[model samples]
Target: MADFFRLNKVLIFGVGLIGGSFAAALKAAGAVDEVVGFGRSLPGLEEALRLGLIDRIGESVAAEAPDADLVLLATPVGGMAVLMQALAPHLGPQTIVTDGGSTKHDVVANAYAAFGERVGQFVPAHPIAGAENSGPAAARADLYRDRKVVVTPLPENSSVAVARVCDAWRACGAVLHTLTPADHDRVFAAVSHLPHLLSFALVHDLAVRDDRDMFFTFAASGFRDFTRIAASHPEMWRDICLANRAALLDELDRYTAQLATLREALASGDGAALEAAFDSARTARRAWAEGKLV
Candidate 1:
């Protein structure tokens, strides 16, 4: 099938890892003629250009957005509303607006508030890809390859706009899946957000211990692997946790209950119960890793 949208320019609202990687991937595929990045840091945007991730720096969303056929808001979830409002008047009817946000409900709400009847052009997406490292320097053209990009189109979204966003991700070698904004938040809250919070909590716990230096000195591969996500950008995760607060809190409560059960088992010397719990988790993880479950 032919490409859905051939872009003259793709305006990126943040020139960090996600935005830089998107620009690099699309530029490498020849899907976009130019990638203009709008960001707070001129030096950072310049660095992205120097690395060839973007073609130019955008001085203002009002000025840059008018010329862009597609605008990818790769900013943090908290910043989406402001950026959407800023771009509202500048966006043309033909321009498609999409975002790379971890949480969608708030972003979709921002879209409606900014564009109203023109919300059809706004398609919300969340790319299930990233690394512990961030910034333009950490961007990779193949970051989205084989990664899942979830598209949660609002009711007012035009089919053309949704398809164009899906096609753009596909062009970057990402697999696409569609879900409602609520469903996306619910699933990711349990799988992604909860784990990240656990990781952060674990690290924070260790960091406050009296033997903290000793703990770090002896920390092994297991600790490193388990705490990797804790190293991610704090402000970004903070916004996501708050944006999907209800779902995240529900998942957190369930996880805490499980931990309490395990703790009781350990304290009561209930070896059989502990063994059964461990075995169940081990079996389930094995099945997931072996692709028996999707």
Candidate 2:
């Protein structure tokens, strides 16, 4: 059989970093014939066209999706409802729809709402590769190389559709892992989402302090590294936080309990208790850093 990824046309709903990089990678690999971008911003679309990331730009996914063999939604998780509604009527029987949403549960719910029994056509995926920078200008063909792309296939999803999505990502040089939507959201909440929230909170807390300037002046590499994610697109993170609120809140509670334990240790001047807690965390982090856990 011919490769399903070698498509006649691929529609990218949001032609920014993730979408643009995907287009570039697939085009370079000869896995797609023509890539068309659909989005609200014409200027951004034009820039992507100029950068050779897309062959054309259209205003309506409903208008453009009918001809597409594949539709890649790279917009924020919050945009899923709109995108799904627009493309619902136009998706061909054989067309494969996938997304780059960081959180899967909400997007999967949106797909079920839009496509109903045909939700199997929409495969929910999250690419672990992300950059502090965004937009079409930051796109690179190698973005997914050696990176993990997690696919959380819904029960309604067809095996064929899931396999095709996996093969496509593999062709783009991504390592594929399969998980349930709940598992994907829970894992990401604990690891990615929680860290980002903490980073933003820390930066915001420091910013409002009376000695913010003085504190910043004395800050070093550790602070910079920890807070780097705070520079991420605020709107995107906001949407993610809301969409994955349940899982995130669970993680926050667990984290807060840990903090409370540490605070108790510090307040009681229990150096040994503090040392034990710190040592356990340090050892776990060191193991992960050495790729023993990851």
Candidate 3:
């Protein structure tokens, strides 16, 4: 076991959902001595403080970054570049910088360019957990428990820095997983991004149809469950979609082809083909749910 080091004066940029929840989790776990939140918005910082998500508020990234033992970037993916540039000069040699950005390749690449070898201290991570709701008001300290957190370390990353980040996630009750940045993007493009896109498209299609109200009235558990991701933040999803455009497009094309096959099977009343496909999917899903497959 690695010797546990309690973090001191952690600085969190962006006190919204993920950031706020992380601050609350670290505080509850007694892993950090003090949590300082910095954001462009004053209301969010006030709310985070009021909710006990953070101990103090930093007036600016430059003022806070140098003092933090751990600096976390929890802003939207689209804002990472700007934040990276702003904090570059202020980051101390010993500070470990990490981000909760959904996409890692671009964020990590930009960090390397901006901070050079100091980027070795930056660990890119994505906690695969969230609710439909966002902001400090919706933040919950227990949100990270049992969640899978993927950390992508570049060849230049310091082993000590990586271990420290893995320890932080472990302290927060997360199951840690390591992967290359490319692999992370490819896997999530299929499992996370594609499903969200399909859900939003399905809901939009229903809303524009003549029988929209009727369809919604009859919608039950399955429909509700399937479309739940459609309620996620539109701007965030839009950024994700654009960030992983190539992988997402490939997955979209494959999904469309499968949908076409199902459509043709239904139109032609091909019972045998339909039954075989459905049975295969059901067995696969059942195995997945039972943890029988990797």
Model 1 CA deviation exceeding 4 Å by range: 1-5, 214-218
How much lDDT does candidate 1 score?
0.90
Off by over 4 Å in 3: 1-3
| Tens-digit lDDT string for candidate 1 (1-294) | 155446898999888889999999998888989899888788889899999999888877777787778999998888888888889898877899999999988888888999888898899999998886789999999999999999998888888888889889988999999999999999999989999999999999999999899989998999999998999778888999999998899999999999999999999999999999999999998999998973
lDDT of 3: 0.88
Relative to the true structure, candidate 2 reaches a TM of 0.95
Q: Model 2 segments beyond 4 Å from truth?
A: 1-5
Candidate 2 lDDT by residue in tens digits, 153-261: 9877888898877877777889999999999999999999999999999999999999899999999999999999999888888999999999999999999999999
Clashing pairs in 2: none
Please tell me which predicted candidate would have the highest TM-score against the true structure.
Answer: 2
Worst 10 residues of 2 by lDDT: 1-10
Which of the two, 2 or 3, has more lDDT? 2
| TM-score-based ranking | 2, 3, 1
TM-score to native of every candidate shown:
0.92, 0.95, 0.93
lDDT of 3 by residue, 158-193 (tens): 888898888888878889999999889889999999
Instruction: Choose 1 or 2, whichever is better by TM-score.
Output: 2
